[model samples]
Target: MNIKLIHSKVNAVLKAASPITLPVDIESIAKKRGLDVLPYELGPDVSGLLAIKDGKGTIGYNSTETRVRRRFTIAHELGHYELHKEKSDLFVDKQFIYRSQNSPITVDHQIMEHEANYFASCILMPTDQVRKELEKMDIDLVSEEGIKHLAKVFEVSTTAMSLRIDKLGFF
Candidate 1:
């Protein structure tokens, strides 16, 4: 399917259901989705997974990741379900690199990654709300603690939160 089709379909889903925003809690979503969430030690092969068989959703992750990283991974996997699950029942995310938006990468990979990241950020911290929050703070307040708090509010990692903030032009 075309990217536009995928974007429209994803947006429709979000419109039909209230998207998760403030206090973005993945555990809550997992519980709501009837998923069994578990943690595994981080390693070279550490990644996130979601399987649906027999009418159940199961999500697994590397416990070694920081809370933020874990949240992003979970969110990314969730994106696959929301946007591409009918095509494949499973997804494995291996790397969690922090890259610039301009990084040279495959077009398709970059686009999907961008969308997943966008989905994660929007689900955790809707752009409108984040912009409003930024309006009340100084421009230079994107500190580690501040980012962490925003991530907590949005249920994402500091890295993801920072990227979102930057993308939203609040930085």
Candidate 2:
């Protein structure tokens, strides 16, 4: 699917809900959209599972993962719930995602994975919200230190924040 369309969809959801805030309440957002979010002692390799049956949706995330990772997992599952529910009612992310020599995934599966990932990124770190936060911070926005600090502020991983910065073309 188109990246811009993905972004717009995320933005629309954010706008229609309560005002955008730091450390987005992902679980609440999912719940607001009629999804049940829960923490489970999922398999070591599995990050999350999105299952929708009989019009009811549940998001199960790995409880052992870091708070940051769990947040992303929830958002990723929510992506599948929002964007791919029509195609299939289930999605599993490991590593937290699938793509291995042992169990190879088809191209279509790869595409869905990619889209869900992008959706997660957009939901968890909306571009406008990130830019607004950057403006309020006095630190150097391009440094590793700044990235780490922002990651904490956004409640996302440092790597995720770094990628967001790079993707926004601030390097």
Candidate 3:
């Protein structure tokens, strides 16, 4: 997948979505894109899913997950709606795709997962915003407490913050 292209697409979506706030109003952005966001008591293995029916799209997140994880799940499903709609009308974002040997289809599925995750990270923890936030911090991001503080500010999990930092080349 072309990572740069995904970034560009997400930027455009953000522009159209407008007034992006911290922790992001993902539901509002999805609504602006003509998609509905919903909460569901999904099975343990499933985090989120995207469904398109009658020419309308809906994203559903597992309500049982922590707030941050649920947000990520929603964004992940939104990523599928934005980038993989042509690939499938429905996407089940489950825990894992069992490994398969030398399967092109498996590779494609993995690529899609990566793309969706990147999309979610970019939207939620935008590089510019992250930099701006970091500039205002006096704490060292290398420490667990520091990372957790930043995550709290972004309303994301510490794990998500760390991954985004690594992706942004901030380390």
RMSD per candidate (Å) reads 4.5, 1.7, 2.3
Whole-model Cα lDDT of every candidate shown, in order:
0.65, 0.86, 0.85
TM-scores for all candidates?
0.69, 0.93, 0.92
Tens-digit lDDT string for candidate 1 (51-162): 7777566778888877777877776666666665665566556564325456555676566666665666666666667876666665355677778777666666677788
How big is the positional error of residue 151 in model 2, measured in Å on the Cα after superposition? 0.2
Give one clash count per candidate, in the order shown: 1, 2, 0
* Model 1 per-residue lDDT at 129: 72
Residue-wise C-alpha lDDT for candidate 2, range 7-49, written one tens digit per residue: 8778877886669788898899999999999999987899999
lDDT of 3 by residue, 38-77 (tens): 9898888888899999768999889899899888888888
Stretches off by above 4 angstroms in model 1 are: 1-21, 96-113, 139-155
Flag clash pairs in model 2.
93-96, 94-97
Name the candidate that leads on TM-score. Answer: 2
Better of 2 and 3 by TM-score: 2
Candidate 2 TM-score, true structure as reference = 0.93
At residue 102, give the lDDT of candidate 3: 50
